[model samples]
Target: MTWNCGNLSSKLATEEEYKIYVDGSYLDGKIGYGLVVLKDDKVIDELSGYVSDPDAQDSRQVGGELVATKEAIRWCQSRGIKRVAIYYDLDNIKKWATGEYKTRKPLTQNFKEFIDSTNIKISWHKVKAHTGVKWNERADELAKAGANSQGATKKNGLVDDLEEKAKKFSDYLQRRGYSVNYKGIYNSQAAKLSLDDGFQDIGHLNIYNTKKLHLVPKYHELRDKSKQSELEELWQEFLG
Candidate 1:
């Protein structure tokens, strides 16, 4: 669960702002990063990368976080975006941004230099991990997918497709006049299961169940179920 109830419908206060959430995943000896960019609460883009160097002195977790953070800023820069809001679960990274923490390691130095060189004005947000935040959870999924990646030729299509579908579904919800929380809907369902209870292991059960949960009548009343019949068909087609 990477989302919470309080922030489900949260939106950026200004039009010039872009929200970016970054997360890192370390599995076995591999490391990866997840980067998400959003505008007006709609996902505009995302990226993930795997770091193959296990011999690096810095831990994979730190390396992934640093790389994701640096690249996120670079992404904003490339887009000519000057006002950006960055969210991460790592406290050390937040502290480093605020001048409350410092390190002399080459990796850290390089990251710091990159930040100083960037002209973007960034607002930093520190969020609790695994609390059901939509973009944050998406980043976590991407990072895990990256960690599991074998190489350029072995990219994971399933994860990527699921992510894209989820974003499109979220957009659909917005268009349908529903302020749905993509990750929170799944978490709300998962919370109902008793501890130690095991259900059929659907691939990416969260995404699957979230779709099912929304298709019913209880979640929210549709503005026009008849008008949305076509959307329902498209949705089912994608899921199938």
Candidate 2:
């Protein structure tokens, strides 16, 4: 355990004794990844970051953890923590971290940079979360705080393609007189899956209040098939 030695403690941290535990919490109902490094119940380092809607199109936490995990790796490396035992509440993170999911979030060059430069060795462990494991709980709190931080939507104009896509989905919903709220996103997604998995093409979906409305994509297709009018000559009509 690091005593209260102020700034000197960090510089004097010995490699053999520099053990760290890493974990993350993504946005609620989404993956907001967060990690905390502890040396005998004392916090040496922590990091939290998220992947969220650019236009606040929806709160998609699962995707955000991919971004967070990348950041977590960078965080660990910057601090010179070479020997790490990374823990996650979700087994999927372990799977993704250890290369079980091949088609996981696409990594940027910066991600590759971290991977190539590090002598850090990461070992993953799955912990029983919300079970009062002191450091784990602290990690949860840290992750939630990061996930909920105010950057869910920031228009830098650099995100040309994604912004366009998000806007297209936004415009489609608006034309249908449907407004986006948390429940609406899920309901829309569920209704989309009910139509075809491509229903998520509309945007993030949440079915929290699905009973109140009938968001049937089949109905949309039948009623507004003309929306497909912009298609090529082959689809001038359904059977064409």
Candidate lDDT scores, in order, read: 0.59, 0.43
For residues 106-192, what per-residue lDDT tens digits would candidate 2 score against the true structure?
332323333333345555555687898776777677667766753552423223223223333332333233332212122122422
- Stretches off by above 4 angstroms in model 2 are 1-31, 50-59, 104-117, 151-240
Residue 84, candidate 1: C-alpha displacement in angstroms: 0.2
TM-scores of all candidate predictions against the true structure: 0.56, 0.44
Candidate 1 residue-wise lDDT, 211-236, digit = tens = 44443222123333343455456456
- Please report the candidate that would top lDDT against the real structure: 1
User: Which pairs clash in the backbone of model 1?
Assistant: 1-130, 2-130, 2-131, 2-132, 2-133, 3-131, 3-132, 3-133
Error of 2 at 89 (Å): 1.2
